[model samples]
Target: MDLSVTVDDGVALLEMRRPPANHFDEVLIGGIVDAALGLDDDPRCRVIVLASEGRHFCAGADFGGGDFAADHVDAAARLYRRAVRLFEVRTPIVAAVQGTAVGGGLGLACAADFRVAEAGTRFVANFARLGFHQGFGLSVTLPELVGRQKATDMMLTARRVGGEEAYRIGLADRLAEPGRVRETARALALEIAASAPLAVRSMRATLRGDLAGRVRAALDHELAEQRVHWATRDAAEGIAASLARRSPVFTGE
Candidate 1:
């Protein structure tokens, strides 16, 4: 299973079990969406702690992989469809980001209501460097979390933001000691679960009004842009350079 769900008291812990980088594909994202939706319907689950078992929370999609590049447009559309469902869940979520959250991995972290990260945790928006448009609703969620200027800076520059900087810039909601990210996230979730479940969900919904609709609209635009870029020479060069761990040289074409 790509995901595991365990409930304790009113907290549902949804762990992504894919190891090392935890790179996601359609199936993995679908499983996560299904698990979250299932937890949403369970009255016993008042909150969710999104976590991963690996050195990195998620490294994003493996664009170099055959499965991802095949039928790129259709695959992206299907992935976005499932990704949007994450926003529809009523339960509040706290993410434990222990390591690098790059590209769509950062998108997943931003999906949570709160995030707990250690000082070593790194958040990166690397699509521009990859020569593609951002996906996983980052066009909406990135700016929503860190404001338009900061989001643009991260996306365009493709810089890594450590946990301290992330917290200062409003990217990470809470900072944890090294090796305690998941525990801290669970503690925060427990705190949220202590509240009246109905009221908590109601308040969360009010605060996030129309977020799902906005993300859906953003995904359409993002996907269209990505489709165009995917066929470009720069995109190919960028992917090759990344795999080779070198700087990409782009041409106007």
Candidate 2:
């Protein structure tokens, strides 16, 4: 949950330092919200670059590392509360996405204004595969980026989308080469930073238009659905199958 923030040339870089796979929880998500809110008050910061120090940008939640089933309802509620703040930020964000952004991680990427990814990068909306409902404001953000049809397909199929396809579908704004994702993301942030700050913020506000509120409502519904699914035996099997590295045999229970 180590998020480092540095500002230079009107661009604020928020780097998540969770090695290998930057998995997130309530505390980590809250830190991101806090960092973004602080950046909003800085007149010098026009753009934010969200990057991760890891092999994978973010592999969603660490289901195996923690007692996921314990007090999950409370934990999810807290996480989603912070997630809504991500959309409330005034500064534009360009996410440097390497490796995989799965489940909630995909939601995190979509929270940014733009995403830079390499050909090998994978974007996965894997909640259905886990027999769980999608969270992290994805209900609104995903469809907003790639359209409702594409978002529905991704969520329902729970398939992996390569960077090229993601870019083509508008899920990713830029496609970088291997090992250059962060550079490309920073470059994009610099380009945005060059614009008139007031004008950019105004335009972004108008374009986004109550997105944070919409995400807030969506998160509420998503969390409720997740709570219901989490109690099911299917969810148990799905989590077990994923941890065991095998395909889940789901019986509609």
Task: Please report, in order, the local distance difference test score of every candidate based on alpha carbons.
Answer: 0.91, 0.91
Reference-based TM-score of each model: 0.98, 0.97
Please give, for residues 1-253, the per-residue lDDT of candidate 1 as tens digits.
7789999989999999988999888898889889898988998899999999989999888777746767677788888888999999889999999899999999999999998999999999999888989988998998989999999999999999999999998999999998999999999998999998889999999999999999999999999999999899988888889988999998945
RMSD in Å for candidate 2, one decimal? 1.1
lDDT of 1: 0.91
Q: State, as a TM-score between 0 and 1, how close model 1 is to the true structure.
A: 0.98
State in Å the error of residue 197, model 1: 0.6
- What's the C-alpha lDDT at position 82 in model 1? 86
Q: How do the residues 1-253 of candidate 2 rate in per-residue lDDT, one tens digit apiece?
A: 4889999999999999988899888888889989998999998899999999989999888778653546677878878877888888989989999999999899999999999999999999998889989988899999999999999999999999999999999999999988999999999999999989999999999999999999999999999999999889889889889989999989977
